[model samples]
Target: MKSLVALNSNDPELYLLLRHILEAEGYDLRLLVDVEDLDHLLKVGRLHAVILDCTPDNESSLICARLKLGGQSTPVAALIPSDGNAQYMKLIKAGVDEGMLRPLAPSRLLQFLRHQPNGASADGELGVLAEGKSLRQHVLEMDLEAQRVRYNGRHFGLPPIGFRLLACFLKSPNRILSREHLIAAAWRDTACVKQRTVDIHIARLRRRLHAITGSEMIRTVRFVGYVLQPHKNTRNPGSDVFQRG
Candidate 1:
């Protein structure tokens, strides 16, 4: 059977372009202009994937969050404006699998769809929680499936961005991660994110970790970026130890 994909968009041009591309590739395309219909459609049928047009108001981000929180595993891609840095971040935090800049190329759209669940490159891995895998770093354990972190025998929830930021740190423990690198990993290459924004988020993440570990796991490099120390170390003077930046 051909794969069925849904496009929730109000742009006629996008609809026509994607319909041509998808039908030519032997896929079934469904266009939905009204957001109200999405819930009903989800109840009645199965979709291989969903592509959303992320408007300035970001109604689509809410829809993507609903889909994920409702236990739907369908992959969601969003078409966003090139300069919509804030909107792009919101979409990613809302569980969008991919974001493509608007005036999108046909090749890019095709490539994204082809890697979806039942698409040509479907590798059975969906999101950050791929294959129920968990990431570990010293005393910190991240349950990707649960979107929670375990430390000191307690489980705590983090915002999606926080979770991703910590995952990046865990992947490269005991290494200094520049603000640029953390932005790329946590915000998915949103170039307009200010350095201060990274500082704020890192401060918030530090507070979350501090609540659990009661010791500093992240250290500031003074004019450089921050480093993740997997094992607790209080020997370093002038570290971000117990102090929120």
Candidate 2:
């Protein structure tokens, strides 16, 4: 099937440019001027990717957050202003997959879409995850392609940073992960992220995991860091599984 991409943009010129380019490359493009329309489409349609025009007043970042929180892993790319560092950071934290600086190049947008696992060619061949396999520990499984976490038969979505932090913890289960290690794993622009930010996102991840498993799977180690513990109901529930590193 031809990949379908949704463009949430008010710019007629940019829409025309992307439609022409994507169609030529064997993709179908849908242009949406309203955020409500985009949200509705997301609920009913299978979008390979979403392109957002991050106008100063637009809720592109908010939309990105909603899409991720709602368990939709469709790739989202934002067209941001040339000097939109603050906006870019907001979108990243909101779970946007990519951001292209405006005066946006059609080629760059095409390249971004082509790189997404969902953005396959007209021949229907699927793309692969560059990160390789899903991380599994006990009953918890992180589906990289679906971008959701499964725990004890329940599935849930997380913000991008939350997802990465959980992946780090899962990769080294029962081992303490320092803030620096988590920052390296979770944030692309780590220099600006403080240790406190890591704590906050970890708290969020912990809450989500708790909601799914109904037990504290992550244990904080004072000034050291945090470790992922096996579920309380698992075999040897009282065992000392947490390893400090």
lDDT winner among the candidates?
Answer: 2
lDDT at residue 125 of model 2 (Cα atoms): 16
Q: What is the lDDT of residue 167 in candidate 2?
A: 75
Instruction: Kindly report which residue stretches of model 2 are placed more than 4 angstroms away from their true locations once superposed.
Output: 24-26, 65-75, 85-134, 143-148, 155-162, 178-180, 186-204, 219-226, 235-245
Looking at candidate 2, the ten consecutive residues that score lowest on lDDT are 121-130
Which residue runs of candidate 1 sit more than 4 Å off their true CA positions? 56-58, 82-93, 123-171, 183-245
- The TM-scores, one per candidate, come to 0.56, 0.64
Error of 2 at 186 (Å): 4.1
Q: How do the residues 116-192 of candidate 2 rate in per-residue lDDT, one tens digit apiece?
A: 55556522111222254566777777766555677766787665567778878877888998999888776654545
